[model samples]
Target chain A: MINLPWPSGLLAQAAPAEVDYIANSWLGIASYLIAAALFILSLKWLSHPRTARRGVRAGEIGMTIAVIGTLLIYRAVSYKWIFIGMVVGSLIGAPMAVWMPMTAVPQRTALSHAFGALAAALVGTAHYYTLYGDAAIDRFTMAILAVEVLLGSLTFTGSLVAFGKLQELVPSSIKGLPNQNAINFSILGAALVVGIWLTASPMQHWLFPILIILGLAFGLCLVIPIGGADMPTVISLLNSYAGLSASLMGFVLDNYLLIIAGALDGSSGLILSIVMCKAMNRSFTNVLFGRMEPSAGGTSDDIYAGKVKSATPEDVAMLLEGAQRVIFVPGYGLAVAQAQHTVRELATELERNGCTIEYAIHPVAGRMPGHMNVLLAEADVPYDQLKEMDEINPTFAQCDVAIVIGANDVVNPLARTDPNSPIAGMPILNVDQARNVVVIKRSLSPGFAGIPNPLFAADNCLMLFGDGKKALIELVAAMKEG
Target chain B: MHNLEPKLFTFLLATFLGLEVIRRVSPLLHTPLMSLTNAISAISVVAAIQVMSEGHTTFNHVLCTLGVIAAMTNIIGGFWITDRMLKMFRREKPRRD
Candidate 1:
């Protein structure tokens, strides 16, 4: 059989032979290039909701091509193990994809980041051990692998912690742990120092596992103190870490496609985390250190005492009846109660009654960035009616009734007025400017900032206290009847 | 090309391209966009494949198998969920004039 090498143009055709070295090589490169293009196109397609599905198709196809290309290149001694893995993965993953409610997207996303990072970490470990045993590892490869494993392991545990917090399986915030940030920094510093040591001396096999342990410990410490309000930034940061780990693994394994995909994922997560931090007027270090100030102070009663007016569902319905334009401000509480559908129902009733309906979306609303949009979109809320914070803030005064549903900080007037507050200078929905502000909340409980909202006590604001879903349902029924 | 120089170049350029593309994605589609990018990144399963084929030891295969499973799950689950979520974002039918 005749054959060409890596640079040969005749790679489109290959002679049949054992291993088929040149044939597989060209095919691999071709597949990776096509997959890379497809991946880029996939994200590009997401620029609009109308074209997003095509993007998904592109991503799916890209992944398919990459997988098939790998199988073509490396013929395992026994494909059974790889086959079993794929089958078992499909069995577990398909249900997770199909059964997860839209409200659980953030948790599901965190879990996936964990899985992806863990996978990369394991592969890197395997490669490192294999080379160590052969006594053939190089400095560059070792250094990159050490960093990869560190990042991958931390990302693995960080994403899990994030998932746990989002699932409420663990406390979302653990503050005032006495030098908590110091402890976290030390743990992270220990892991990095260990990673550097591992790079210099690959013979000290015990150090590799120590690095893993420290990485895992640091991830836990890093995420535990992050409050509920910082979830969007935390999740985005985890996503970025997971992607960077994978990218570093790509360098370790010399995989072109992995590098491109990882870079894309990393940059995407980076941009989102930045956006989330900006929305809250926070820095990356503040979120990284997991420092949130939840003052259990006298503000709640002091601000809310005699100034508050608690109303019934019927009162809210009556207000809606008289209102021409109504805007909804949803938050984490709405997600917690799974009240998006009920809110949609209320919006429909309002629409039918000739009331203009718009949803005001704060950038940092819900458990993650854009989370509220996904929930509302799932409820079949028209995309056009979902107005962003800046777009809708100026129009709040024209709104006769601003219904704050399971929301707190985003609509709090304090974010704009109080410079010393935790959420100070954060762009809020400006719901107070509306003629009548009705807050549908469970109670006078403070939000993640652990501060009382002055909006609840304003003369124009009426608190309709109840479970979010139940309250929205009652209001929807009343709206229909009225 | 001789060292990791070309790869570093590729990585930087790809990340820059990603930022621009992701920036344009409507905030409304951020959830789906995240899932899609993650699924694409899970293509590191190909690397896991290469590792599994390297040595005949049970330890290597086991680790590689587990790695493959994790990446596979991310790819399947991520794409499937992203597709489901994107489909949920719909526009209202045109109203009568």
Candidate 2:
């Protein structure tokens, strides 16, 4: 029989006897190189919203190739458990992706960090015992494993705590234990010492579990003292930890793909942490240690004291009806009350009346970085209509009306005027600069930072008291009627 | 197996590359960026596979099982969520022409 590059015969014939390739093999190396290129391309494509979907596509393709390539490298391992892992994971993961509401994205992000970290830590633990059985572990590999497990375990628990806080399953307030910072630092210090000791003497089996326990302990210690308002920075910092652990896993396995991907994740998290810190105008230390300094700025009653003017939905409708330029400042309240879509309806109604509408998104506004953008974007608001703090701050002056929806600290003029206020140095939306300011909130209750917003009491400001979504729906109906 | 020179070099170079490549991602896409990167780091699935290849022991089986499942979850969820999020961001013209 003449050789025809025999199609079906080749696939079925060679499938059982084909040469297995490791990452160092020519084909495996090529696959890794291609995967790495795709990853870089994935991140690069995210430079604009227009190209972001393409980024996701590139990432999915890259991941598939990496997984297939890794699977082929070894056949001695039992594939049964690995197969079940993927299947069970998909069963859980798919629904989470399909059914989760967009507003739940923060908790979703926190959960991702936890799972990633937990996976890395588990792998490090397995590597330790596998080598220890054969008594062939080396100092360098052991050292890298120690770092990997420490980072992974700590981040795993820390991220879980963050998820709990975001989900409100755990109390979000700081427990304010005495010498809290000192205790946290010492726990971390002890973990580092144990990790270093285990590295030098790999035979000390007792030290290994202790190292892991200390790491797990420090994770809770690190996140427990931070309040809900500080979650953005805390989450970002945990992201960096998760990625760093993965990078150390790379070093242990000598897998260049793991190193590249983990490093990318680490740097991405690092940059986000910087952005979040700058947005809040607080350092990592201040946010983590204690940022709840009493604001000598006094109480909400002192600021409001009958100076506030209350308005109804019809009154807000009339104000919107007369406004030519309107801006919306949305905060965590908008997310809590699920008012995003309704607010968009209100904005659309006003836009039809020839009012130029924009939404000023404070970077740390909702709960995490880009929180408001995700909520507003999910409502089908055009990307161009969503403006960042820096871009929209100056434009608030030209705005005929600034509508504050479930937003407080971001629009509080006290940040700029009162030096003694806790939020004084943080940059705020210049909502007070507008000709008329309307706030939609449930009550005069203080925001997360527990400070009164002076803008609510300003001469040009009026409070529309009600639930955010209900207020928006009523105003939308009123706008349609008029 | 003892030489660590090449691995260290690869890690350093890759990290610097990461710092450079990720600097340009739009802040607007940060939420998606996090999801995608978290998924990417789940490449630690490769590490789990390595661990599973070791001689079968109860401890090894237990560790690798947990490792694979956790990593797989991140791998699946991260990519799924990132794509879902990106799909939400588009320029919708609410303009009445």
Candidate 3:
């Protein structure tokens, strides 16, 4: 019986131990409600580019409240372990968020999903351990816990592998993958069978670890065959898995809040995955098994290197000076270089010079969907000035100068010309149809899909090589000088 | 000041963290995430309803009804919002093509 300090006469008649416990409990609950409100507000605010930063802050507040509540509720031998966990998580997470290059944003997103999955899995495991050897625990509870743990672990490992692939730590596309679909299906089937077995015999705890392993393997199999281009879909699918795991864990623990939150996450993740699939004009099944290997015997370097012609900033500036209509195509490169402000400045200058400037946005530009929009909006680019691919493709033909910044596959002509190309038949921005094209890029590197674009080598195209941010600033300066 | 209070606190904290994760990832996932989170937040409805059905004080009953309504709004509103967003993504077939 631990003695609790409370206001005098508040709980004088009650046992000191119970009084203290109750007070602490109430404190915890109050924190949780506050956190929930913040969470809801954060999500609502995040929907638009205007409030995204605020949304991030709100989310942080909620997470802080949650961490505080968790620490207060759990009786530990010492606070050392809790502090250590917090410190370590922050040390790793902070650098990853700030220092990580925008080029590696996809991998970073995947890693974040893995962290989320790991947290859910850890919670589920802790719940199981807390109830270990309790015969009174029902079968349904055990089954839910097992499922949560399995899915959580699977999502964790799968997201890590995705991160690896996206980071180019692993090859972007692997070839000679015959009957990959059969292999993926077989693994999934085995995982399901093992999951059933684990649920049937919770007393045999060894099956729990085996189920986790099977799930892990299944996640790897599911993601490994997927091309780098399809990473957005894969990340979304893993997010769903993580959410489902959390929901199942909530059910096991009879926590209504957990169940609600987890289910929401899972369903949304699923929907997003479907949306990404649609954006790519690919089905979910095709995303999983479709291995779009670069053409055999044609190295990535061979396809892009020396084939393209370069232009100076002065040349690009002169080209822009005479152009009546300039269409800007922004891609991941713009985001990586954090060139939104510079791009916006250039647009403002162009507009001031009486050049009709319009931005062309592809559905699948940048690492995430709406990435360009968010970046552009941050730089105060007008919403009406940004045109979707379908709306602007026809207008490009009449434009005098098409300025492509860090965009490759989305603007590539190979998608239309090469029958064997992985990106074949995908509708691309018709920047090629423009009178003169100025491609701003850091280097002649292939896109995430590892496919070399022939548009850079086209007679109409002049590659302006430099960091997107630097190039845009120089372009703005040159325009001002002219 | 009760055991349940601490549980509530934990729930709130977890909810906030979960929401942040959703927010950061939402641009990638789109409106479906919002709809899903809305559904998850709706769990308060179940809690409210269960408390009400248990035949607690009249205050509890009122609270429960409010919870249910909030949850229903989240579910119905979420789906409606998602449907609207999906409509935005739809490509109109070119007349020539």
Report how closely model 2 matches the true complex, as a DockQ value: 0.57
On the 0 to 100 scale, the lDDT of residue A140 in model 2 is 82
Please report, as a residue range, the 10-residue window in candidate 3 chain A with the lowest summed lDDT.
A1-10
Best by TM-score: 1
Which run of 10 residues does model 1 chain A get worst, by summed lDDT? A1-10
Candidate 1 chain B minimal-lDDT segment of 10 residues: B1-10
Model 2 alpha-carbon drift over 4 Å, by segment: A1-24, B1-3, B94-96
- For every candidate, give the share of true A-B contacts it also has: 0.75, 0.75, 0.06
Off by over 4 Å in 3: A1-30, A70-79, A293-316, A333-352, A373-398, A412-427, A432-435, A440-482, B1-97
Better of 1 and 3 by DockQ: 1
Best candidate, lDDT-wise?
A: 1
**Total backbone clashes of candidate 2, pairs 3 or more residues apart or in separate chains:** 0
Show the lowest summed lDDT stretch of 10 residues, model 3 chain B: B84-93
Candidate 2 chain B weakest lDDT stretch, 10 residues: B1-10
lDDT of 3 by residue, A72-143 (tens): 544431344334433554455445544544345456557656766665555555444434433334566676
lDDT of 1 by residue, A1-482 (tens): 11113354444445566336766777988998999999999999989988999999999999999888878777553589989999988887898899999999999999999999999899998888877777767778888988888888888988898899888898755553789878988988888888888778878889988988998888877877777788899888888888888888878777778889999999999999999999988899977774567654456878988999999888889988878999999888889899999998888888877888999999999888799999999899989899888899999999999989888888878888777787888888899999999998988988878789999999999999999999888888877777
- Candidate lDDT (C-alpha), each: 0.85, 0.83, 0.63
Q: Arrange candidates, best lDDT first.
A: 1, 2, 3
Q: What is the TM-score of chain B in candidate 1?
A: 0.92
